[model samples]
Target: MSDVSTPDPRQSRLFTASELLGYLVLAAVIFIVLPSVLDAFRLNLFGKYLSYAFVAIGLVLCWGVGGILSLGQGVFFGLGGYCMAMFLKLEASTPENTSIQSTPGIPDFMDWNQLTELPWWWVPFNSLTFTVVAIVVVPVILAFIIGFAMFTRRVGGVYFAIITQAIAAIATILIIGQQGFTGGVNGITDLRTLMGWDIRPDSAKTALYFVNGVLLFAVLFVAHMILKSKAGRLMIAIRDREDRVRFSGYNVANFKIFVFCAGAAFAAIGGAMFTLQVGFISPTLVGIVPSIYMVIFCAVGGRLSLLGAVYGALLVNWAQTTFSESFPELWLLAMGALFIAVVMAFPLGLAGLYDDYLKRHIDRLLAPVDRMMMRRAARKTSPKAPAPTAQAAE
Candidate 1:
């Protein structure tokens, strides 16, 4: 047999030292290189992309690992976004600020819609603390209810997806139909400032972009921890063999519920941050179509890899923005083609591509260097050889 030793199993771990080093490199790029290189507008766009990365990472946990695909993730995202939007609108609608409107202390759209008084539900958003709480809590509560109802009943597969899709549709309809209450068909717009600070400035955008980057890394760390825990293994078990997992005396439904709720919360936070950075949230982002597209982000990223998800969301969204601005109609066609290719050709997405085909080749390339180092170490540790053989020959 060849003398080359086998690869260490530890190297394949989800968060191996080398894997962590990769994250560190990526973090450096996000926190250092990109900010230094890109202008304010480009940086702001990247910040928006990072917000989408949150959703994609959450999807990896829920759909990729737990095998619970939710098409209504946008509902949670929109809820969180609207919560933040409500708070910003309230700030912008102060008595002195909106004196020109019929209702001096209501959102511009509300005043335009001829509302003389603030809506009851909009009251809580007046407090930033409550709005922040609601951003996370609302999505978790809704996800818990839906998850409990369906998972316990053993409702899953495509049926669960359809139900989620229905929820997204209903939410979009409610928002569009209730013009006065829900910002109507236009959705929430004309957002400005946060706690008296102007959000329109480039400096503010840069700060928010860094904030987005930090939160994204935080999410990645949490996700990596989850995947490294026992619960993460159980999630995988439940995904691949649900009946077996149930037979193993585990409450598969509860596990599913936990992951699903976690996923919703992540998506919600992303939505709230999106509002903060982009300054608006509309039905366009929270509708079924958009939610479906979000799935494509996860699918393209390699749903099994958190880092892949981030990269996938950024690449796809960047491409979408670039192509849409330039080609418009052709962008849609290209995106559709990409979605299909991901499903059929690259089933495991970019992550799998790296792990399966590329990784082994990379290892092969490095093996000779590793062997050379090993030989050098062995020689050093071994005793020194005897002196020159000329004396022995004599």
Candidate 2:
């Protein structure tokens, strides 16, 4: 008698229908019910979280999936933000008949610079089309060049992270030093409008919130698709064993650069959207600290899951906003402790834990159905009795 126990095949398929329904229901609650109930301030705060989500997406792609630790996403984010800020500032200044060469006599930093004429580079940014294009293109180009050089030279791991941090530091310092052009340490602020729309109005803020929501959805969808594709599989392979992948006929360098560039571009888009909503841009927003914070968001959310990155960014930022005002002194410490706890307890991240728990629940719920299907399949595939054996017996 054969005593082999066949394994159930139902466990192998990704995400069951009930699981999908649960996700859809959860999404509906967030995108539909929450917005309707939340006040404008809360909605705006959520919008800011969504911007952070954009940066977290990049972190997940590079660090979580591609094994590239980039500590300089803030630089790219700042670059895109400042680009938009420049155009907005130029537009606001020009209508008031202020020449780039003359002192605008508005912000203290610009006043102290003792300069008026808009820099040559600032001219193109005044064009809305140019600003929009720059927001996406500039970061991608920069990432491509930097990533191409670094990956080609085989610079990775902690060294790559250090280089990225250094770049972010340099960028912050450069923006601070170029007082005349970049508004120096004070950065750029006192923005009034974006693409000619009044940012101060409730309607505009609401519109901005919806825009952010749509962008977040779009980014999440794209990320999900990429993660499920052949290229994504190759990325995982490279992450697991780079040399083996190289030997298996894949150009590891190209894949790394591609993901790096894509992450940068996503960050830039988020930065631009953030600048538009906030109606302000500053170097502080794009410094080393913020870049590190971006990584923290991804780590806390569950680096391996795209949804985790988004959830982490939103949850962490929400906590910062909620507690920092009331307990300013303890806020940073609290955040740090929370991060440590998450890293220590849930190394796979909150999303990973949630997913694992969900899978277990689903397996239990579907066990009977799975067993029934397996039995039916087995019966159908079982061998028929031999008629000759019966006739011989008779």
Candidate 3:
């Protein structure tokens, strides 16, 4: 009789050994190979892109899987970046460090804007621990409020998107208007160091790059764990048939809130990392335009594929940087065409195309070798096959 206790294939199919290998390979490329090859300047750019990849990763969960399109994910990203920036600015604005400024205790921008005292809100960011926690928590709190209100009221689709876009615009205006507190239209700049370590050095950039990569994979793993849970299945169900999901007795709003909060946390962490790697954070990166561009990263990467999202962020930004530097005036026109083509031709993004066409071919190519390996494994495991194996060989 066949082995009765064989484990169900469904139980482990999500992350088979080969699939895990793929993830490992990707990690090595990011952490090991890329740093070794690229110059300091190029690698720093890559590191910056990786920071944005974190935002794309959040989009994969929030927008792609949950069927929630947040046109203002940049809000969360900006919140995180600003949290880090606040801490860094505080460190740089010590009385002794900024003795030259008219007001030595506050950031130079504050001095420039004629502010004499640190704002109460900016005071709490003096603690690195609080700054780190605030990076994730502040965004989650905002997301929770928004998701709770909107999902509970069944306000969704384009209306939700419009509201988010509005939030981004408002945030931009507020940051610019609050010049002393937020550093105004210039945003935050002249960040000197992080905890006494000079982040301006080439070595620090490389280290930060690896740090970003590792954190990214950790986030990706967490997202995968979530999607593998019952809640994830419910997310897919809601995405497909919201009425059916609601009728099944699930708290649809709660699920939306949870996922949205999770996405915000992920994006927030990314924003913090971005600030660390890039040496500055600004209002421009937190506005509606950047938020829409972020969505395109998820869309082009195949929203359903987490790994694809990282790649999508990298590729899109790389293209943006390359084309803008080389072609300047034509870059926007080309980007518009690319977006149209992606929407019209590859609705599911690049991952969908791979699944639809390339994956089958890959399986076909590997089938014979896989079969031979499996047969060898089975032969070794099976009891009486030993004697028959010699006769079969003969």
Candidate 4:
């Protein structure tokens, strides 16, 4: 009689330490190598891409994970940028002529419009701390109010999308209309300083870039942790079946509102970072078209995957920058085509496709080893199997 030891059940499904170590090593290599290999111009481009990635991460949580298609992320982003811009403007403006109400004290557009003083509401934004806090807090508050009203009323799907889009459009119009206050069509420019640092300096640009990089990683890590938590699982459940989750004693409205507020805050933070990098903020940046484009990035990237959002933002923005420089007229068309192709061919987005492809390839490669193990088990179990017969069969 032959005795054969059974394979350990735990061994079949567990991740070994070595495997975990390998994954960590791979991530480290990517983070270290990618920036080092790129040139300064490319690095700047990457900074912009990272900002877009931040926005996309928020969209993934709200729209992709939560089943809400928000087309007004640009408005939240603009709000953050405008808040930062307000601080920068206040800091840059001469204290002697601080009153924008005076003829020469107003911004160029306001001066052009013959406006004398800054609006009352703009007074609070003069404080840098208040402006910075408003950048984050205001968007969240707005998101909460909107989400509460909509979700509680059971307004979702297309109606939600349309309402958000309309909100974005109206915001753009209002900003443009208030030329004296917002700088109108030209937006805000001549932004030379941010928190007393000269924005035009390469050193400041590099510093901002580093700050952006840290924020991106921080946001990504937080998102990764959330997606792995119980709340994240409940979010997924809510997305899949809101009615069921509601019946299961979960506060579906609260979950939706939380996700929405979180997403808005993410977008707002990205916008603030973007304003620092670009040294300007404008109404066009928050227009309906740009907001729709933000949605396109999430769509082209796998909505369900965080990595997909990041990659989509990076690739699409890179393509836009490159193609727009060479063929400005065709840039939008090219982007639209690319989005269509990704949706049609990879429905899961590039990351999802890559993951599925890798999984299938690994399964295929392991099939032979699995068959060998099964054959060995059969041979050990057989009472009178002949070695010569097995060798002949082999």
lDDT of each: 0.86, 0.80, 0.85, 0.77
Rank by TM-score, descending? 3, 1, 2, 4
lDDT of 2 by residue, 289-379 (tens): 9998899899999898787888899889988998998999998899889889888999778877887788678767877765555555443
True-structure Cα RMSD, model 4:
10.4
Clashing pairs in 2: 100-116, 100-117, 100-118, 101-116, 101-117, 102-116
Shift in Å, residue 9, candidate 1: 6.5
Residues 213-277, candidate 1: write the lDDT tens digits. 99889888888889888899999999889999989999898999999998998898899899999
Model 1: number of backbone collisions: 1
In the order shown, the candidates' Cα RMSDs to the true structure are 9.1, 8.7, 6.3, 10.4
What is residue 237's positional error in candidate 2, in angstroms? Answer: 1.0
Which is superior by TM-score, 3 or 4? 3
Q: Taking the tens digit of each residue's C-alpha lDDT, what string does model 3 give over 165-268?
A: 99999989999999888998887987878888888889998888888888999998998888878888888998888889989998888998898899889989
Off by over 4 Å in 1: 1-14, 361-394
Deviation (Å) of 27 in candidate 3: 1.0
Error of 2 at 185 (Å): 1.9
TM-score for model 4? 0.82
TM-score of 1: 0.88
Worst 10 residues of 3 by lDDT: 4-13
Error of 2 at 362 (Å): 4.3
So what's the TM-score on candidate 3?
0.90
Which of 1 and 2 is the better model by lDDT? 1
Off by over 4 Å in 2: 1-26, 97-112, 362-394
Top-down lDDT ranking: 1, 3, 2, 4
Write down the TM-score of every candidate.
Answer: 0.88, 0.85, 0.90, 0.82
